[model samples]
Target: MTTPVEPPVPPADTAPPRPGRKLGPIADGVGSVHRAWLEPLRHTYLTSGLTLSDLSIRVPLAKSKISELLRGCGLYPRWEIMHSLSIQLQLPSWPLHRLWRQAAFEAQKSSEWVERSGDKAAVTTSLVPPLDHRAFRETVESDYSLYAQVFLDDDQRDTAVSNAFDILWLRWNEALASPDIRRFAWEALRATVMARTPHIDGRPEFGAAAFDTVALQHLTTETERMDQMAESLHLFKAMSWLPDRQLDVMVMRRLYGTSPEAVSDLLGLSLATVRSDERHANHFLQSVICPTPETEGKTA
Candidate 1:
């Protein structure tokens, strides 16, 4: 009898449908960072030989609040509260902020994807697409302000995002080895910011003094480079004064050259809402530059 012949295998893409992919590092990293922060808080109490009650007294927080934080109740303290703890514990605020931001980002990303894609199981079960650094950055870059806005003011948020990318590049090798590369880069940056924060005297406060300083730096007949840098810095300081959401919307739409529809998608806003935000942001800036009588009257 002739040997039986088998049909050729189908292309891999034609294989039977599989269940959702594992989210892997996305879920794992978020939880790990949460624990990372909580454990240190608990350790501080332990190493100081203070009970939760005693710690509450020093932190000026309720014992229950301290307990909730220690237990990871999903509510992070405000920066002011963290700052207080940092002072008492001599721990840098940067690490806690960094970890907290990562945790928040991951949680929000998972929730938003589930909502948008209507794939609840995939997100909640940690069964989603295979994520890599480029995909992760693209996913998070749009609403990066969401995670960052929690810890940084509007002006600082853009700077922080830019800085994080730089940090990621500087530590590419180490970051590549991380179970969650994005989280690792962020935490590294947070540590760097915290470490350096103590050495820096102060940041440029948004005020007349800030503008005056910039003006003083301008040459009587500036080179093209100096003029460009001065203009850029002036605009940055001006933009910083806008409301948080407005600033975020403006930065993504203008600086990144993202389209309005794309901006809406990224920011989870309706098309109309995105346009309105941009309009309002621009109006606010224009009003500052050339005050309408109405605005001047309100100011007066």
Candidate 2:
């Protein structure tokens, strides 16, 4: 019989077990817009050759949870997970955060939920607020508060503004490095406020607070008040239908009396653009609220 039979050698293609499974395609449930950022993340993972196990070790998530995130499975993962993953993947967190925020909204997560999750995540990783951030807050806080108050109660306004500031604080390094910090901060504030602002037919609903404006507070007679209220409602409805840039311009210039130059700087728009938007917005409103006889004839 036999010389001892040599143990069979494994095939050359048989390799050692990988550290973890490779990422698969994003789930079909993930929207195309979401895929915009998720694709980059998947590419980063693939190129880095970091396995699911690697992400679990780097981020605090479990291996299964990390896998679900990369594949866009299950509920939208928290901002904490996204933020940590961004850090590990060496992706710039600021742009990722913006996309993640949008995804969170699409996922039906409330603004309060987003704010709370972000606050909890930030607490663990937060550093001292940079001096420039503090200075920036001081410059914009009052106006931001007033703007938010248009859509929220005093307490809610304070919370919204504070949450915006917190977001800016977390991303201040990126903000400072950007070409225009004012515009960056303004966007953060706007996003925070708009997330909380109620919508009707996919438009920001300002009619609820129409009665609260200073313009309406001085009317003494019931008839004058009712007429003004009707006009105010019409005006606010018209404003709601304005394109976002025009609405922003009208709100700042007409409601807050901000100068056009200031609106340009805050919105990261050119002065000419801001002025044009305001003019277009006014024309749209006048057409809606007080159509000229010639326009009325055309409609007739």
The number of the candidate with the highest lDDT is 2
RMSD of 1: 19.2
Assess each prediction's global lDDT (C-alpha) against the native.
Answer: 0.51, 0.73
TM-score against native, each model: 0.36, 0.65
Each model's number of backbone clashes?
1, 0
Q: How do the residues 154-271 of candidate 2 rate in per-residue lDDT, one tens digit apiece? A: 7768866876776676566556655567766877777767766888998988776677766767889988888887887888887988887798788888777788877776666777
Off by over 4 Å in 2: 1-53, 60-64, 70-127, 293-300
Candidate 2 local lDDT, residue 128: 47
Can you give the lDDT of residue 262 in candidate 2?
A: 73
Model 1 weakest lDDT span, ten residues long: 120-129
Pairs of colliding residues, candidate 2: none
Candidate closest to the true structure, highest TM-score: 2
